[model samples]
Target: MITIPREIKEFIELQGIFAVGTTGVNNIPNISPRIFFRVDENVIYWLDFFKHKSYKNIQANPWVTISVFNKDDLKGFQFRGIVNFITDEPTKLEIKESIIKKTLEKNSSEKIKKLSEKIEVQVIRFEPKVCYSLNPDEFSDMCIGSDVDSTQLFQK
Candidate 1:
């Protein structure tokens, strides 16, 4: 797994939702907005509610790319990774606490607790293999943590 740099990690944290790309048995591409996302040390996780289309797609193909950006700044990042579906009591509780406490930073413990009880959540854990710049106009898909020659980085 590739380590996500602090800049990229902060970029991800600033965004509330992400567009996740996936393809199912027919091999057609799908991009769906995903919330309830959390980034741990080396892995990222998002929630799938009610077995959505993205969940079905991942069942057939685990490969996915998560994209988030700031329109005003024209800055973005795309994370390419494989997802593993998890549905366990402990994981759900951990997700609940992390998402509500850290990512959302919500102090409405009672309200969030009630909401968490109502929703049946399926966690999609992401293990990123590579990451790249979203500014193709400027960087030409410069990879953040790749093994490409340093000279390539100098071109821009």
Candidate 2:
């Protein structure tokens, strides 16, 4: 498992949403915007509100790439990882509460309720194997660490 650098960890945790990419057959990928997501120290979790294409793809292939980039600057980190579903009801409930809190901060109560109702509530726990910087130059200036390749954070 790859240890997340502090700078990258803080940057990711501030994100309200993420782009989750899952590959289909022939290595084609489907990328989707997932609003209900969180980045932890060593893992990332996002609620699959619907059992959509990404969910199906995860079932077939656990490997996924998740990214959160600045719309203006296009600077961020992308992580590649293996994911497994969080089946425990307790953890799922906790995640729900956290999501509700986070969502409520920036959304109306009615909207939050509507969003909550639509949730299939499938929580995915991603254990990242790599953390690649979006820009090598900017990444260096951040002075995060010497260990990160800034190009490729992991070895196959």
Candidate 3:
């Protein structure tokens, strides 16, 4: 299991949306934008609100990938792993709290507030099997893998 670093976690928190990728048994890929997501230790969880395609895809194939980036800085992290749908009370409570917290933040729309209350959100958890950093310094744009000690990748 790989542990997410503090800097990466902080960067993710500052972002408004995350891109999640999943593929079905037929190998058709699906990407979706997610807002209600939280990372804890080695697990990353996101709330799925009426995402029928994503829900169906994950059910067919457990493997998934997540791409997170700060467009302004042009830096990002890509994570690949296995995913599971969790409907446990504790995780559901966490998702509810996240929705409440985001609603309290600036520029939250009435639609978002209403959706939070009405929708049946599913908590999807991702356990990272490997991580890669998208670095553009090289001509080919090298992607450093975290399977080996990820500390080396963080050390500048």
Instruction: Give lDDT tens digits, candidate 3, residues 1-156.
Output: 688888888777788678999888777889998777778778888878785888999999887889988777888888877899887888677766775576448337888666667557787889887777754543223434445454453345
> What's each prediction's clash count?
0, 0, 0
Decoy 1 TM-score against native: 0.79
Q: Cα miss at 116, model 3 (Å)?
A: 1.0
Native-to-model Cα distance after best TM-score fit, residue 31 in candidate 2, in Å: 0.3
lDDT of each: 0.75, 0.74, 0.76
Higher-lDDT candidate among 1 and 3? 3
TM-score for each model: 0.79, 0.78, 0.82
Clashing pairs in 2: none
Q: List model 2 lDDT by residue over 1-156, tens digit each.
A: 667777776676566677889985556789998777666767777788778788889998898988777766667887778899999899988976786677667666686568777746788898887666776456523423333453553335
- Which residue ranges in model 3 land beyond 4 Å of their true spot? 103-107, 138-156
Off by over 4 Å in 1: 103-117, 146-156
TM-score of 3: 0.82
Off by over 4 Å in 2: 109-113, 136-156
Which tens-of-lDDT digit does each residue in 1-156 have in candidate 1? 777778777788877778999999998998998656788767888777657678889999898888988887888888777899776879777875677556446334565455555556787789886677887476745567643353443243
